[model samples]
Target: MKEKKQNAVTALLEYAGNYKILTFAGLTLSAISMLCSIVPYVCIWLVARELISVLPDFYKVLNVETYGWIAFGFAVLGIIFYFAGLICTHLAAFRTAENIRKIGMAHIMKAPLGYFDNNASGLIRGRLDSAANDTETLLAHNLADIVGTIVLFAGMVILMFIFDWRMGIACLLSAVISIIAMFSMMGGKNAQLMADYQAAQDRMTKAGTEYVRGIPVVKIFQQTIDSFKTFKKAIEEYSDKAEYYQGKVCRIPQAVNLTFTEGAFIFLVPVVIILVPGALQSGDFIDLVTNFIFYAVFSAIISTALAKIMFASSGIMLASTALKRIDLVMKAPTLKNCHDPQIPKDNSVVFKNVSFTYDGSSLPALSHISFKAEAGQSIALVGPSGGGKTTLASLIPRFWDVDEGCVEVGKVNVKDIDQHVLMKQIAFVFQNTKLFKTSILENVRIANPDASYDDVMRALKAARCEDIIEKLPNGAETILGSEGTYLSGGEQQRIALARAILKDSPIIVLDEASAFADPENEVLIQKALSVLCKNRTVIMIAHRLSTIVNADKIIVLDEGHIVEEGTHQELLDKGGLYHKMWNDYNQAVKWKITSEKEAL
Candidate 1:
């Protein structure tokens, strides 16, 4: 079964939920207001009829003042209704936008953590926050205007033929031409161009965010804006899209639309001239003049109505594109939870014939791989870059689900375990640690929210962060990444270790945790690792071979396959891939030492 495609207005109304009633009420009121507005024009015709019937005997026009007051009253009533309609729409529009943002965020929160790696935070925020704002204009003002204009047009059609059909046809011709021109700008291939223009805008927003985030790198490299090629390209693409849509696509159609829309009375003058001889022959020149006055005044509203349609149509297209972008974020894959979740019996982790590939990729990141880290065992994964070390580590946490086979903890498949329970069993510390801009106490307490202040203090002490805390003014209460209280990369790494220590999970997955630390910090990080790894089933990935030489088991991976697995000394004796990598690492370390001494 295929799903029914909803129009933009209908899709947006879904987000309104209970507020949809307000939107309907607003449209109804707007239509009634438009009908009321037409009464004044009818009154003008009646006033003209009375005055012309008495021809130069102006005082004989007894109903002229009555008609004037009626026109004034209807005009005032129209304004009040219009304003009241706007109030209803504005309230609904605000709630609709709020719901869009709230629903988008809630959906995104359920998405897998790995999704953020491919989708930039800026792009997601722009889609949810800014795109929702775009829809507000459509719902608040454009929708009401559209409804009012439609009602006005329907009433105009009936009134047009009532006086003189010929004059009515002439007045309607301009509106017909204007409608055609407006649709030409929005319909067919041009609709696709508008969508492309919006896509380019999204790309520019994403690129701008990436450029801003990389500004520090740019400054460090002494580079200019031109050096940020992606941002520059995105800007150029957006400009080109805007230029092409406005200059090439919309230029002629827009001109035609505006010319016909504003000049709706253009055809009325010639039609009245043609009808003059017949009126004179029928001795009804007074009627002709009166009907001409009515049509002429009515033509003015043709311009207002057509202009509303043009802008309203534009709003519809913009909102439709915005909803599509929101859909992209909402469609992100989320980790599926088992209905009957099972708890793991033990801390032992095992992989059985596991093979996984990233989305949109042909080759597997890990192929037919099997390994185990028994409770309290330390297993180190070491290999060249892109050897599936990080990918394998990520699988244990179900960052990306496996394409084949299963990962088990305590003999229970990870997919069968409750996501929250699974997360509680393992703690991960990556090379690039992220700390929120909050107090140090809060940052560490995130790992174990129920843990007491004393427990956090003990974890920090165990992670060898005493020196870091002592140097700060407020100790654990000091805010990080603000007020000049920023920690060095190594210091941040130690703090991350403290977080993991506070978590106190039986399984710890460390991915190049000390890769960015300076030599002094490296020593401190190693000491912290010792405390963290104690009595835990540790799965460590490291480029620094020295750190993992003493592991109970070392696994060497290459091109998604495990090439060798054994104790470090046993692998060294075997002279396999691990042995060769160890030799290369030793040569690099010796070269670094000699280079430093020579430089001194």
Candidate 2:
């Protein structure tokens, strides 16, 4: 059996959860309002009939005031019902949008951390938040208008034919043409054009976010907007799509639709003129004039109803595109949790013939890599750029899963361990550090929520942040990135080290932790590393080379493969890649020292 696919409105109702009844109630009320609104026009026809029956004697119309009051009552009733419908739909729309945002965020939260590398936070927020907002229009206004307009058209059809079938058909002809024009713009190949236009909009939004975040770099490079070619191209693409969709795809159809929709009486006028002669011969000229007046007044309602359909159809298309974007966020791959999780016996980390490749890449980042860091031992990964050092470190904490083979912790495969438990066993510090806009005390305590204020202070002290705290107005209580309380690159690194120290995990992974530190801060950060890595199974990626000279084991990697493995002195004795790298490091150091002396 084939399963049925849901349209955008149906899918949105599902998100409304318990509020689905409100949407139904709103639509019903909207339909009733449309029926009520038709009564006023019917009253007009009746009043006209009575007046024509007693021509030239206005005082003989006894029910004119009664019909006027009835019309006024139904008009007021229609407005009340419409407002009540709006209230119901507004509540449902709010709930649906809220649920969509929550569900989208919850789904993406479970995805692997590596997924964020390709998807930016701003882009994700735009997709979920902005797209959810777009759906509100369809739920609240467009849906009610659509239902009301449908009911209005049904009532109009019966009323039009009731007076005279010929006049009814003539009035309906313009509406038929208007509907055809509207569908021509909204359906078929133009529908695909709308989808493409929406896609171009999404690309533009993502590119704009990236451009804003890179403003600092752009200014530092002294570049103009043209320097960001991706952003410029995205803008141009969006503009082209907009112009093509409006000018080429929608222009003729839209013009035709409006022409017929606003001029619904065009066909009715000619039909009434032709019917006048036959009515005169049959002594029914007064009835013809009354019916003509009725149809002429009724034609206004046809224009209103068709306009609603046009706008509602446009809203439907926008909501469908928005739902597609929301689906993209919801469909991101999440890290699979084991049915029966295992606990590690110790902190030992191992990679057994691990081969991993990033998504959308033909080449593997790490291929057939094998190494182990025993409990309480420090293993260093030293390699040139693009040698998979960072990729190897990322695997230990399951930031990304291996494509083949396995990463094991304490002889248990990482995949078998519960995600929370696996995370508690390892603490990773990246080359770049991010600090929240909260107090330093809260930032450090985030690593261990149950940790006391005293515990956070102790961790900060161990990380040698006393110098940083002393200069702040509120010491450790000061908020970072607020009120002029910002830390330098090295200072932020120390704070990150403090977080890891507070976590007190059995395994620590450091990816070039001191890579960006100045000479003074580098010494402080190195001291902090000593305190954090004590008695832990440490996996370190280093580019400075000097930091890992005394490591328990050194693995030198090149081109995703291990080319040499030994202690620093043993590798130097072998006179291979490590030896040449060591010689180069020495020469660089000598050049730095000679240059400084010459400047002095």
User: Best by TM-score, which number?
Assistant: 2
Clashes of 2: 0
1-600 per-residue lDDT for model 1 (tens digits): 001113788899999999999999999889999999999999999999999898889988799899999999999999999999999999999999999999999998878778888887777887789889999989999999989998999999999888889999999999998888876877776777877887898789888988998999999999999999999999999999999999998899889987987787789889888889988999989999999899888888888888888778778878887888788888999889999999899989999999998999898889999988898899999998999999999888888888899999877999999889999999999998999999999999999999999999999999999999999999999998777889999999999999999999999999999999999999999999999999999999999999998999999999999999999999999998988898899998887444766888
TM-score per prediction, in order, is: 0.93, 0.95
Instruction: List candidate 2 segments past 4 Å from native.
Output: 1-6, 215-222, 593-600
Candidate 1 residue pairs in backbone clash? none
Q: Which whole-number lDDT from 0 to 100 does residue 404 have in model 2?
A: 97
Query: What lDDT is obtained when candidate 1 is compared to the true structure?
Result: 0.90
How many pairs collide in each candidate, listed in order?
Answer: 0, 0
59: Cα error in model 1, Å: 3.2
Every candidate's lDDT: 0.90, 0.90
